[model samples]
Target: MELKPIKTRKIYEEIVEQIRELVVRGELKPGDKLPSERDLVERLKVSRASIREALSALEMMGLLEVRSGEGTFMRRLKPESVIAPLAWMLSIEKGTVQELLEVRKILEVQAAKLAAQRAQADDLRELEDALENMRQEIVNPELGGEKADLQFHYAITRATDNKILILIMDAISDMMQQMLKTSREKLYQGKYTPNILYSEHAQIYEAIKRKDPKQASEYILEHLSGVEEELNSHIE
Candidate 1:
């Protein structure tokens, strides 16, 4: 006898779907702690591995948060909640990094310009501090560079004193780091990376130091556009 077609899914994947459905359906609100592992084990009738895998998927989607030594809680959903899915999609969709960077390029360049025009003395000091940290990281090539780089971008946005702008840019911090790593990879392939970025970053710092909005904006556009061009050249 011929066998009928079988329908199947990885057990964890199905579990993940159910949990996400509950969350989207409002059965699980933001900040709600999920049931304990043992409770889920009995409810889902799945192995520990399956349960763990489902939880991992949910965590990656920003639908849930797991605190060390504490229970998992749901995160506040909105645009921020969408970031995880966007990031995962970008990873799967071929040739989208350049587009992602372009978006950041536009947002950040505008923020940089505004920051320069609006920044007060205290803002300038913060920006200078971040810049100095970046320089030290470059010179020493320590693992601390990522934090410094993030602070550098943040300083510019903070200088703008636009709470919304600062928040939005902060949300995309992960994406920025991802894109920068990719850009650096492209540059590394051509032996054109490390020194080049350090100098360009310095130029932006200099413009900010002078509080020249026009020059800061121009330099930011030029720098980010160059990165986009260099990446698209090969991947396209």
Candidate 2:
């Protein structure tokens, strides 16, 4: 109920905070439609632009879903959604890209190790499907291939069966997607051929399929390091 008239210069941010607070406090439960934009502007005494901006921000955070011809509704937000504010900050901060990649390497290395030991038939099928998607998309632009690459990594993480690790991965999924896209584009533009990329992923898949945790971890690390080198080469 701290939803008062806006007094701050960052009116949109204040509005976002108040609405988010209400949702967090259970004042706005899941599937509860919010007031119209005009009504919200009138109630908060803020400009229409500010209200729109606030709602858009909340939508990006997965807190609100805006339906066409219908009002916005509160969503049952995930832990990843709650971490979005931090994720945004990390995305733009200096030197954060390297830090993010390093963290990804650490988490994914462990994930790969665990996947090697615990991956069931379903998990193996998922990984194979993802890899096949990547292979099929190699002749096309990197967009579809990049998406499949992400799916492959996510499958490995799911194979780990660690909820906390999965949540952490979800929290940084956006940034990770961007990084993969950039690295892949750079690799394609440079020395890497489509076949080379396919080979790298296939090697990793083979290691995991063999249930060799050590080999899986090593292959994934090497693949990531190669990607890091490609990115660094562009910077230099």
Q: Highest TM-score among the candidates is held by which one?
A: 2
Clashes of each: 0, 0
Query: Best by lDDT, which number?
Result: 2
Per residue, candidate 1 scores C-alpha lDDT tens digits across 1-236 of 11112134567666765666676677788888888888777777777787887788778776778999999888887665554554454444445676677777778898888877888888778767766776776677644455666677778888888877776776666767766655665665763455676677778878877889888988888877787777778686
Clashing pairs in 1: none
List, residue by residue over 76-119, the lDDT tens digit for candidate 2.
87766777755654554534557777987999999999999999
> For every model shown, what is its TM-score relative to the native structure?
0.58, 0.65
**TM-score quality measure for candidate 1:** 0.58
Task: Give the Cα error of residue 19 in candidate 2, in Å.
Answer: 15
Q: What ranges in model 1 sit over 4 Å off? A: 1-95, 142-146
